[model samples]
Target: MATDGQILRLAQWLSPAYPVGAFAYSHGLESAVATGAVADGAALTDWLADILRFGAGRSDTIFLRAAYEAPPEDLPRIDALACAFQPSAERRTETTAQGAAFARVTAAVWPDDLPDFTYPVALGRAARLHDLPLGLTARLNLQAFLSNLVSAGIRLIPIGQTEGQRVLTALQPLCEEVAGLALTETLDDLAGTSFLADIASMTHETQYSRLFRT
Candidate 1:
């Protein structure tokens, strides 16, 4: 169990205003909206659910777990895998850019020497440095990711605030489920079958009049 101060630190790191610039990335949702793939609250919920179960959400959770548990010397392999795991250029940019920014800011404040890594890998290192529990870290990261997406959906899909909150509320159980699985899972078990989401990311790379970087 984490102490109260540990929990607060994790919360602060995962918060939306943490300087990670998460608001500038949609993880492909903007393209989904443009293509009419996610046009309403229900569609948005299903899209998010699929990703949580079988997309970046699952893979990132696994990566975070692996990095949190692995020795510092082994993190580079994990980082390399995370970079290669990105299927699209835009997707790659999304993770690496945020990861870089996250590492830069956290290292400056915490005085932990961090290697260049993707967001999940960087987060896992930060968790270890802060002595935060892995389960709590994973859960909070998932919630943050979901919240960022819902915020984007509010802008792109035009969903009302209440509807957006409902969508996030619906995903609470799944967030717990994914976090639990991530805690016990190994890197080899990582796989994401959210093909439509992957395609949307690829399509997002060429999307005209975009509001997000990915």
Candidate 2:
């Protein structure tokens, strides 16, 4: 269990104002919207739910737990695997950029040897370093992840604020499920078959006019 102060601190670290530039990336939703694949709140909910269940979201939480328990010396290998796991150039850039930003900010605020690993790896290690509970960390991280993309959907698609909140509300359970799945998962379980989302991210690189980076 996490103490109230620990929860508060974790919230602060994952907050939208955390200087990680998470808001600037869409995790491929921008392309989904451009192609009309995600137009309304329900469609957006389906897209995010699939990602949370079978895509990068699942794999990231797995990596997060692997990082949290791995020996410190093993982090570089995990980080390398994470960077290699990105399916597209834009996806690679998005994770690494936010990761580097996360490292820089967290290093200033906490005693950290954090590196420029992908976002989940950096975050998992930081949470461990600060002694935050993995369950709460994963849940909140997953929520923040979904919320950021939902905000992007609001801007890129025709979704209204209430609609967006509905989407977020609909996806909350899956976030909890995925985060819970991360608790006992290992690197061997790391896989994401959300091909459409992957292609959306790849295709977004050439998208003529884009509001989000990935």
Candidate with best lDDT: 1
Q: In each prediction, how many residue pairs overlap at the backbone (N, C-alpha, C within less than 3 A)?
A: 0, 0
Model 1 TM-score, all chains together: 0.98
For each candidate in turn, the TM-score is 0.98, 0.98
Over 4 Å off in model 2, which ranges?
Answer: none
Model 2, C-alpha of 63: deviation from truth (Å) = 0.6
lDDT tens per residue, model 1, 1-214: 7899998998888898799899999999999999899999999999999999999888999999999989988999999999999989999998999899889989888778887699999999889988899889999999999999999999998999999999999999999998898678898898879999999999998887999999
1-214, model 2: which lDDT tens digit per residue?
6799999989999999999999899999999999999998889999999999888888889888888888899999999999999999999998889889998899988759998888999999999999999888889999999999999999999779998999999898889888887677888878888999999999999999988889
Give Cα distance to truth, residue 52, candidate 2, Å: 0.3
Off by over 4 Å in 1: none
